[model samples]
Target: MKNNRGLLIVLSGPSGVGKDTILNSLLEKSQNIKLSVSATTRSPRAGEVDGDDYFFLTEKEFKTLVNDGGMLEYAEYNGNYYGTPKKAVEESRALGQDVILEIEVNGAMQIKEKSEDALFIFIMPPSRQELMRRLVDRKTEDEATINARLEVAEYEMSRAGEYDYVVVNEKLDKAVEDIQSIIDAAKCSAKRAKKFIDEVLNNA
Candidate 1:
């Protein structure tokens, strides 16, 4: 039999790098991969349901979880606490579901510190100019906000070298295929496949 444990993928990138779009496409084209849902301390917006939109928790409750090691990663964003819950991710992986945590650089680093087996991947923009074009094209934020995001993007990209793999989002479909290929190749790596191979050899 093949290895039964699922891959834990930590995906991180700059704010304007089309991570959401790439993830949407990747999920559609992949199987046995589950996107992780994070918990948040902020009040839910209209039509946003707990557990679906996010696991809404009080600040005290969130800190309690962090202290108990129930959080894989956590950070304060705009005064609201957001964190990836550890238990659900572990459960999904146990059932052979590859779980992807689409978090920021700081959170990704936290996961890395906690789990060395996690596969870390960073999504990159083709270039700085292209990245700026994307942020402007969206027209969803003011000029000041976009500039602030670009500054953060620069800092985030500096950390790309820390990741195990990097995918450049020049074309959506191609990026998805490349990420899928990375996952497929990782599954066959000697480190991951040796146990199953040994079992087969022993049986034979």
Candidate 2:
């Protein structure tokens, strides 16, 4: 019955799987989609700003936000907490902008529970061997972190079956095109285009 409901797009994959890279590219090519900046207890890295990369917060502040039901979803990893703020997402939705969240498997599942109609896309590396190779190639994490992430990747990959769409990142352009098609198709869904349907019926 809603005339202009927004699309909530959730993208999830393991670390070093190029989810962030592909998301960045998609944002560049998108016209009305906005990325949801997450709030994290982790300190800002070398060049990350307070509200740009993430909404950096202290443990206490993050706990406060969680307690007050301010976050859409939250989880702790590597001794730090990360969550999506509810306000920005709602604001963007009100403006009819597509809101994209680059979160983890757990968070994606949470969103699915809350928003059954949300678009869920799981990005996959070409293969496990390629995943490991990319992890090493990035050179961003220490060996211990990389290994830990790989193990987590195994678990996350297992959950890909739960997603609405699985995009294999074998080739950059192909993957992007696949994701773009999914989004475009979602926009034309009957639920989203009810007004158009009604108009045609009334005219007839």
Candidate 3:
């Protein structure tokens, strides 16, 4: 139903991982899901729009939100602060739109602690060697940064077991289908669809 509550989906992976790629591709296929854009203190690059890409703010503004408890979860990366805005996410969910967040490992942990009902997903490549190749192929990072990302990926991969679901991006189409199946299964869970069940039983 249109009035049904939404599901909060937390998606996380390493820096060079395909979280964004998979999410964006999923968005193209699914019309009902809303992508959660984070707020950041870092300046946007050329062609990046505010609210569309990220909610760009100053360091002081970001710190203000942090101190005021406006952020759901936040962390500093490379001297820039990034966080999810709690209010926007809640409002979107209340409107029955599935909110999918692309977050870091630490932020995902925070979400798990706060939103226990949230569905957490961990995305991974087929292997570390393949992951490195994908990162190199991006041509967006230097050798030093690439190595550092690989190191972080190893540690992040260790935390994959903590998530509710693990979808390896061995092949994009198959992974997307797997993710869709997970969402469908979650929607049909007894805990979430109790109202429909009650109505059906009453009618019978």
On the 0 to 100 scale, the lDDT of residue 156 in model 3 is 93
Q: Which residue pairs of candidate 3 clash?
A: none
Model 1 weakest lDDT span, ten residues long = 186-195
Which 10 consecutive positions of candidate 2 have the poorest summed lDDT? 1-10
TM-score, one value per model: 0.94, 0.85, 0.87
Top candidate (TM-score): 1
For 1-204, candidate 2 gives per-residue lDDT tens digits of 344656789999988778877888889999878999899999889989988889999999999988887888999989999999888888988898889999899998877777757899999998999999999998888899988999999999999999999999988888888998999899888877778788888889
Candidate 2 segments whose C-alpha is farther than 4 A from its true place: 1-3, 42-48, 57-61, 142-144, 195-204
Candidate 3 C-alpha lDDT tens digits along 21-136:
78988899988899988999998999999999899999999899888888889998899999998888999899888999888788999888888679989998999999999999
Error of 2 at 136 (Å): 2.0
Clashing pairs in 2: none
lDDT of each: 0.92, 0.88, 0.88
Q: In terms of TM-score, how similar is model 1 to the real structure?
A: 0.94
> Candidate 1, overall lDDT?
0.92
- In candidate 1, clashing pairs total 0
| lDDT digits (tens) for residues 41-70 of candidate 1 | 999999998888799999999999999999
Question: Can you give the lDDT of residue 57 in candidate 1?
Answer: 98
